[model samples]
Target chain A: MMTLKKIAVPVAALILFGLFWEFLVWVNGWPNYKMASPSDLWPAFWKFRWLFLDYGWDTLWRTVAGLLIAVVVGVLLGMVMGFSRTMRDALYPLLVGFNAIPKATVVPIIALMFVGQHDMNTILIAFLISFFPIAVSVSIGLSTLEPEYRDILAALGASKLTIFWKIALPKTLPEFFGALKVAVTLAFIGTNLMEIVEPHGRGLGHLFDSGKISADYPLMFAVLIALAVMGILLYYIVVALEHVFAGWAERTPQ
Target chain B: MTDLIDIKGVRHAYKTASGPLPVLDGLDVAVPEGGFAAVVGPSGCGKSTLTRLIAGLMMPDAGEVLLQGKPVTGPRATVGMAFQNPVLLEWRTILQNVMLPLEIVPTKMSKAQQEERARSLLALVGLEGFEDKRPSELSGGMRQRASLCRAIVHKPEVLILDEPFGALDAFTREDLWQTMHRVKAEEPFTGVLITHDLRESIFLADQVVVLSGRPARTQYVMDIPGKGPRDLEELYTPEAAERLNILRQQIRIAQGRAAA
Candidate 1:
């Protein structure tokens, strides 16, 4: 029953939000081209559902591929920074400066370099934009390890590698998952930015651009709704993974 | 019985931005095989530094630490330690935490044997049904019990308790003291307990060592009468009261409040 309430509440809120948007459009007498109401979206959505799926899958796979690469590289770099004071001091400022650049601006430059390579550009952008948060979180997790825990293991004649695997890795899982959640959203943004900037006729961004050119506002709104649904779905997947790997960290006694 | 742990004229200091801050000077401690010694001193007088030296986590600048007639050059697998915080890994259940040292210490026991040993230790400490519970699920006393189980699960030659019950309530601390006796009887290891509680020292240890103020040295040693599964009731006797009074007086002198 409690689980049902948790699922039902957000879904009911979504329905209410759709109704409010529909009411506002109807009350203002907005044309379908000016703004697509909930009524206008369903037929258009039904008409192009298959296309939406294809393009959405394209975008989703690119984001996922980039995120996988980011996880590997980010974790390695984070471990390095976490363990070595000299490397941390050397790399920290460069990472901050790189993260500060507008990824949107970088997307165009990436497009210029990898002309017509839509998938590669999208994946690279997603990777570049998303890895920073994961790396930073992982480094922070490793560096803040409690001294007492280290001493406990060290007293047992445990080597540094043993301590890393036995203590540091498990201790850092919660933070890793936290950064992954944020990175998932950022990966989507990076992929979408590249798709829209290049308009390679392959992903949801291309479909949305096609809708704009034909003045089909309903189709555009359908694409926006699809993206939102996809984002929410992906975020929940990360949340589920977090529960599996770090469930012990989440428990609170009654 | 020979001394299992010996620290001879050990001295150490920490290098700070200002200069070298001396913590221990001419410090000496010893614990015979299967004997427990409790070290009590004023805070910041290097009681902990002395534990680290014996455990080989750090080397003393000027003196030697020996275990079983061998000088400790680095951490050996035979010294087990518990701190005030318990320090059980949050991700591991009580059983897994107890079995951690077994995983790292190169034990000949098979996996099943290890689990059995850990289970028996947990049962000895009154945590039989709590094997699968996480550290946070247990109360402070229960968690400390689990920590003790973890510390001695591998049957180390020496066990160090660095104020393991300092954060516990008075009743829980007393309960844990009894538990300590129970654990020591079942799994005999030369033990060193660092605590500030006078009653705790007298109740749990065969001998209590007191240290003076900073740049600390051994100030006094008092041997408690009668050991082997001590009852808490023994703490109320007139002899117990005299021991407590002498310890309090020694502590006062250690704190520089009373002249020796």
Candidate 2:
């Protein structure tokens, strides 16, 4: 299919870039400890595949759990804010102030709060990163109903609850998916950052930290590759969902 | 035979930055049961405001709008409306969009009955095969047609259209006019249309009420002279052209007054 061709271009380009990178290292006679070649990383990955998989699964579960909770809470808050001007006025400033704080700075505090539970710390980090986009996107989506559509519903004698279910929820779906895509990537990054700072969690970040401590450049490179693969996979999962919900929307005049 | 709608000395104004600017000034009109009427005027003449009032979407400051012998209070399900934009829910398929009113009505109809009614309406609009297609997949004219189907699917006693075909191309507009005429002929609901197109008013409406500019009031009420089943060819007649020219002049005068 044409879509496959489009995807193939970027994938082929990435493979070529990896080959070019390996060629550059080889030609320059760079030390393996300084910059590991793709060939070196591949052997290292094979040796540590099971260990990498366990870490990846742990981080993945934490991110997924955190993202789900954020979506549920964020959507409810957003709906309340969107439908009630009083609620928005009361809470929006507080939310903005909270969002303004540097999320990275909270990792240490979160770790301290959670103490020994690595899963709890990771979840907190992911939630902090993912919540903002979902809330903001849902609020915007709820507010962006066409005036005529609103008027039509109002004129039809639709109750507030009916309007929310039939109009608001359906209209907000595409936007929610868009926000979800961003949140998923952020969730991954947030979980990884939490791992990096703590260095005790079972995650790619812990793997990378161990590699650095042992001067294992090839292992670190392999972990970075795995992280890239995971990010792409998670992002595509959101994309697939967007396609399901919004496939009807894309046929409009662009 | 009581009037289906009575707009009695309705006055409305908006609080603008400048001051309270009046829009509708003691306007009054009566529409008989099952009558097809059109309100035509220049852009600022508040024709849309009148439709909104009749549909009970807004209240007049100084007067009352009566629907079926009751004073219009708020939006009522008995009144169906369509706008220039199709305003179809992008997420719903054509059948689902048509079935929307059924869902919101609070009267529990069996799902089978709703689907049957939706299909009947879609068939009426010549969209039987397009029941599963999304609004985004339809053409502008097709979408408007679907909107028309949606508006009437619930079988409301009154239907209000605000420039329903204004966004379509000339050929498509003419085609839809015929479609509308046929639908109106088949189902005898009290239909009120607000439009700037003079020919459209004459071709479709039983009575065309022309309005003066803002603070708008009814300037002229002309009876469109046509018997059973008119077509696009009627638009080419001298009578149609004369009516159109008269409307154009009245709109110009109204525009001049608004400017002054």
Candidate 3:
């Protein structure tokens, strides 16, 4: 009952939003080619369901593969950078400098290098854009042990390896989860944005580009709907992982 | 009695914008083996610094701290210490926290034996059922007890407690005095406590060492004559009350000298 009431307000608001959207389309008096109502987008979803599924699978697998690469490289590099002063000073500024460059601009260079393999282009773009956040989060997690806890462990003669396993690694889980929340969404955004760069590609971004040229507004709306659903699904997965690893953390606020 | 832990003419300071802010000025302390010594001083009197200094957590700039007749150049791997805060890691369960030292420092005991020791230590502290509980689930006093258990589980040569009960309420603080005594009795380790409470010093230790103000020295050391079970009623008795008053007066005199 509590859960139902909790969702009731947002559900009602969505219904009103759908009504308002249909009313606006009706008042515009434009044909379905120019404008789409909620009802029109609904059937269009069923009509292009296969196109949506296939393209979505392609984009998702690329994004996830890229995200996996980012996690591996990011965490390893972050740990090394955190442990050594020389490595941190050498790599941190370069990383920040690289992160500063708009990843979308890197797409054309990556696209040229890959030359017609948009799948590779999409994955590279996603990995390049999303990797830095995970790196920064992991480094911060490694750095921020409470002095007393460190001292207590030190007094017990804990070596760096022990400290990493007992203290640094557990503290990093929350930050890794937090960064994953941002990086995963940005991975999808990166793939789609890069996909639009090479519109001859086969992802949702290319489909949207084609729909725009053909003036099929409902089809574009259908792509937007799929993107929204996919983003929520990805975000919830990270949130679930956060709960699994850092569940003891929910009670305390720091 | 042989001195097991020694701080010899220790001179240390922290650097600041103005200049060097001196803490310990030719300060000295010695604790015999299997003895409990409680240190009492004013706020900011370098009491905590003295604890760290003896524990080898921090080095003295111009002097040396020796444990077991050898200079302590780094954290004494076998030294067990606890602060006012439990300082228990949030990520680890109470059992894991207690077992931490065994994992870090090489132990002769098997895994099962080490775990058995941790469980028994928790039970000794009245936290038997809470071995699996996270530090956050326990109350402040319970957490401190768990921290105490963690400190002694490894059975170190020395136990340095810096205001271990300072944060607790009066009732809880009194309760833990008994708990502290009971634990120390069960496992005899050289104990050094840095605290602001004279009564706690008298109640918990065989000898109470008082410190002067900043850039502190050992101003006075008084032996509290008692054995076996300690009772709250004893603290209010004329002799114990008078001893506490003398210690309080000694601290005021030390502070006065520091002010001068």
Give residue B13's error in model 2 in angstroms. Answer: 2.5
Q: Which ten residues in a row have the lowest lDDT in candidate 1 chain B?
A: B1-10
- C-alpha TM-score for every candidate: 0.96, 0.91, 0.89
Q: Which residue pairs overlap in candidate 1's backbone?
A: none
Worst 10 residues of 2 chain B by lDDT: B251-260
**Of the pair 1 and 2, which is ahead by lDDT?**
1
The CAPRI-style docking tier of model 2 reads medium
lDDT of 2 by residue, B155-240 (tens): 88889999999999999998888888777776668889988788888888888887777899877788876645687888898888
| Stretches > 4 Å off in candidate 1 | none
Candidates 1 and 3 compared by TM-score, better number? 1
Best by lDDT: 1
lDDT of 3 at B46: 90
lDDT string, candidate 3, B1-260, tens digits: 44998888889999999999998897878888887899988789898888888777788899878888899988866899899988888878999988888877778999999999999988887888999999988999999999998888889999999999989999999999988878877888898998888889999899898888888888888988776558888889999988988887898888785321
Query: Distance from true position, residue A139, model 1, in Å?
Result: 1.1
Could you arrange the candidates by lDDT from highest to lowest? 1, 3, 2
Q: How does each model score on lDDT? A: 0.91, 0.85, 0.86
Between candidates 2 and 3, the TM-score winner: 2
List residue ranges in candidate 2 displaced over 4 A.
A1-11, A84-100, A251-254, B16-19, B106-110, B225-227, B257-260
Q: Please, what are the lDDT tens digits per residue for candidate 1 over residues B121-211?
A: 9999999999999898889999999999989998899999999999999999999999999988888889999998999999999999999
